[model samples]
Target: MYPFNCSQSTTTTCNASLYHATSLGRHDSTRQIATYYSVNETQLHPITGIHNRQDYLVTVPCSCGTVSGTTAYFHAVNYAVQQGDTFSDVSAEVYSGQVWVVGDEKQRFVAGNNVTMNLVCGCLDGKGTEEEEGEVIVTYTVEDGDTLAASLSRVVGLNELLTQNPGFIDVGWVLYVLKGSQVGCGDFEKGYFDAEGPVRYNIEEIEEATNNFDESKKIGEGGYAKVFFGILRGQEVAVKMMRSNKSKEFYAELKVLCKVHHINVVELLGYASGDDHVFLVYEYVRNGSLSDHLHDPLLRGYQPLSWSARTQIAVDAAKGIEYIHDHTKTRYVHRDIKSTNILLDDCLRAKVADFGLAKLVERSNDDELIATRLVGTPGYLPPESVKELQVTSKTDVFAFGVLLGELITGKRALVRDNKEPGRLKSLITTVSASSTHLRITLKNMDILCIKMVQPVSDLVRNLSGSSLEDQFRNWHASSLFSSYPI
Candidate 1:
């Protein structure tokens, strides 16, 4: 058993009048000061060698005119230490199902606060065994004051915890184990671990299936992680395994993806987590990304995508981006929207993927703006994003404009042939220049004359009265192409 104590320095002022109500006889107008227990560990337990459980005693001071009138209540002390975990991990275990007790008028006891109380050891043991692979496996028991990190440390190797659990063991997994342990001896049975259907591959099984992350099997690499093609349950799947255990962005991405239930968005098949790895499984799109079709010269000639097909692709991509911004409960700003990230299905439908840079904003608050590190591909990024280092849905709109320009002009965003100086420009510039020539072509083609001089005579008739005629006459006198019709 762990030794315990109470420190007077840690005491809080309480309502003396409340304690007097519980006592017999007369009531006192003076404030009551309650005495509570606190504990300090001097050494480890002799038998278990674990410096775990601590108990505290809380005494209510009351003037009952007798020694028996004064009573002390015993309560267990609870506290928490940070063990690097996702928010979900901490919330489910540490805060769930804990009851708060009312103390003096000025004070209250919370679950996270360190407390002292008396409780018997082994009061909650229900350890059993299961036959797995013809061998008996003993159930893991979490005694009082057992933390997930400590419990997993006692049973499995420490390296296994780091290697198998990407995030550190926090209250969330512990609460899950506690709740599951009360029900049965198996793992926590949630949607991801259902038994009605075929069993999905665990982290170990997925690693084995991918040939221990062979470089030859690598399909794609991104800022946060890598993609690999793998077979699971005899079905082809694309597995995006995260690169680091410390990425909060990866967890954010997973949270957003799991909540999104759109047909246009890529579906999440399954996920696996180990100490060093976090894997997201998705359905494989055989045709690959939109960037491959747009930029690859070898692919362009085989099947020339018509203008109508390109316009449809633009509309499909816009709908996906719009869905993230408007349809979701919280508005999502996909900071990174580029051709490469827009995946193409076999039927040529575009699905937006790679939400690692996405951010959720409040609906009611217009004043709220998020300022973080600048992230996105160059040339495709909007001017506001580049200058202000701010990202909003409007930023995505500007990027969409760039994508539309690419679709219309059939040219890359930055790449242009330098030899043909005035030959190529942006879609906006080309359209503006073409409009002038189109008007001239329409005028010259509209008036067909019997002789070449009659064309100039018709041009002079059209422009004889306007102010433009004076400028044309002045320009014609100095120009070498004066014979050519305007």
Candidate 2:
């Protein structure tokens, strides 16, 4: 794993203190500390710039501080290199029901000396799984000499734990137990609605809104659904109608989308269901999409987007994605994030659309990389997603990086290579092949491309991208966009 400056870590509270980590593994020589886990840099200021794990003792962030309000970090640094994970000192009191990293499932952590516990905390009291009701779903990184059995035994039975986990759990590494090992509520039961917050619109109200699905009101079309502009109770709305009878398919997507609400995310005004179709209504965004302004020839010359406008749009979109990843009642991974999906308002502010399109993880762990058929734009798809057909929050971050490249350089994620007309070059490979101090010209805007390009290029290359929260915070605070100085 690469090391980065933990100046701006991803953790929301960050109430924990610093750990001076010395890497026992090799990392990219050029890796910046900003890429992975966040830590307070004040106490143990990390050595930044031009360093590698093989050559030097690079300090890493082992700050297992706070995982939201209810929990604290359980640093499991001291373990007795045993055959299997043993009970630890922290678990002496009582604890159970926290899932480990879903990506690296069933691996033994005996060989690891300094096990890095990077738990993406998802703790919202009322939002826990219906089956897991009062029991919270927060992950705890076990400290060096702690055993969780005592606490876990009190919380849940040994038989229940064995049945849910079903196999051996590695010590030092995180072994969590969420109440249930399941997917979305809808994935199992077809017609059930979590029905937490989103409104349900009657079929007649929807018909009146779109004039009975009139072709004249059509605004968009794709494999997923058909979009129509409508007036719902005097409020202008965009209704997305998907033709399918699988109410089970609609359950998870609708439930996840309903709970998400932020200024940057496109609001799900309500939903409707017909025998053969599903309708999702959203607040209408007048300015179309960032793709329309950046890539469409018809709009580009007519109303060229200002660099100032581009930066704000990027910031707005970043915040929207970050919200779903970290701050939501249940953290979600946006399966498809692309330029067209980012809608622009009349004021040019961005509202991330198609978030409801995100598929739920097969299991409870939010950050787990669930394997499935790969679905994303060609150039925007990260290497891991393409290779493994698995997706996580990182998938969206990778796509957002491509979007950033498009904003800075006015290029599509995939472009027809001028040298080889038959081959399409990706933004990641193209930008990564460039020298550090490059310059570009766009719409009489003599853009200084060198500084801005590094961050964009790093992201497009999928270099351990920072969480949307960290990236958004860094992007807004950056002064590298010389052309669009705030």
Candidate 3:
């Protein structure tokens, strides 16, 4: 048992006593505790009659013989004012009971002033417990020298990765090692050695096809390349072996040709680049060139193109040019447009062949114009092109006009005729002299609906002025017409 005391007011006194006893083997033992004390305090306030000094004690028994304990006496000034009470009023009320001594600092907390009260206490035992764990997940880590394609092949199963993420894999995969010992996959940097596409063929395969570019296999030759008929993978192909190093123009032409899949444009199968050689593989066109058929007099009698056929060829060529100008993302200008550059397939369909001189328009600036060294066939070149007047699409139009004139007259733009000095000059002179007669014939047919005869007589008179009659007489004497047996 423990003794306890209760006291209040400035001069107070209280006392308590505790007694405990336990009997064992018929022998009795007892213990007693008593306390008498007076607590001192100062005057609190002038208002309330309550005391600020108070004390209380409690007693309990313990297992060991009777134990006693005492608590320190303390003065607690506790006064709770009702709502709407001013701090001064609360102080006054507290002092009236002599429970507290009001000071200037206590007066600062006036009524209607926001104030917060905080309580602090101590506990003997306070603790907390924790919860259980969850399941664990497993993953693999990519080490150094790993690629994105390889990592994906391992993580998601190789078959699924190949089928589901083909596009990602084909974009040249990359792997990055993170700071936390993790790995990531993405596209590789451009121009890196690993960024190249899969090789379709090796140098050995191409060499065997061309017979090591033997002179015997060479079918045609150009300014910078030689074309050979080669068998690649059991298929006939025309392989052009470039004579010079790679240039931006060559790559640009290749990019354009790859995208141009029109029937009227030559098809590009594939290209190969090596340390010392560059090769372009294209589909072989069996028929030769338009120039061969047109210029070789021996072949003319065998195949004389009809006017309708000529018109169709011109229209097809125009459509091909229009496509190059309109359909592509970049406008292409064929700086060289001539008959020799046009090839005819087995069906006599024309396809524009050479693109080495083509140029791509880069920007939308109006002042932009493509300028180059003088490079074109003299006879087919336009007058403006000769003077270099900022060549444009109109220059190609002028060249086409010359080709049309050639198809009509069946004569080369520039021909060497010794009988008539300066052939183009003489041709122009002859045409000018007969222009009046030709115009009258056309006019009569248009207005009078009459087939004129004097126009023919004027043509005969114009021919009589030159040595053309003598040439015709000698042609009649030759036996070239005797085979007709007429």
Q: Which candidate number has the best lDDT?
A: 2
List model 2 lDDT by residue over 346-367, tens digit each.
7798888875457654324445
Q: What's the ranking of the predictions by TM-score, best on top?
A: 2, 1, 3
Reference-based lDDT, residue 425, model 2: 86
Q: Lowest-scoring 10 consecutive residues by lDDT in candidate 3?
A: 36-45
- Give each prediction's root-mean-square deviation over alpha carbons: 26.4, 18.1, 45.4
Report how far residue 248 has shifted in candidate 1, in Å.
Answer: 2.0
**Tens digit of per-residue lDDT, candidate 3, span 78-165:** 2343466665443222221111222333554554454322111101111111210111111112222323443233323312433365
Query: Is 2 or 3 the stronger prediction by lDDT?
Result: 2
Q: Write the per-residue lDDT of candidate 1 for residues 1-486, one digit (tens) a residue.
A: 111111223211110100001212223121111111111111011111123212111121111111123222112323332334323332223222121222331232343443322211110111212211111111122233333432333223212432265333332121212111121112321111111111245887678767778888687888779998888767677788896663676777777775453435665667777778778877676667777676653554425444445545665677677657654445777777777788777667777788887787664435234566778877566556667786666666656655644554445555443678655434323322333432242245221111112222233234333344233333333333234332
lDDT of 3: 0.41
TM-score per candidate = 0.46, 0.52, 0.45
Sorted on lDDT, highest at the top, how do the candidates line up? Answer: 2, 1, 3
Candidate 1 least-lDDT 10 residues: 12-21
Predicted model with the maximum TM-score: 2
Distance from true position, residue 269, model 1, in Å? 1.9
Backbone N/Cα/C clashes per model: 14, 22, 10
In model 1, state the lDDT of residue 53: 15
Residue 222 local lDDT, model 1: 86
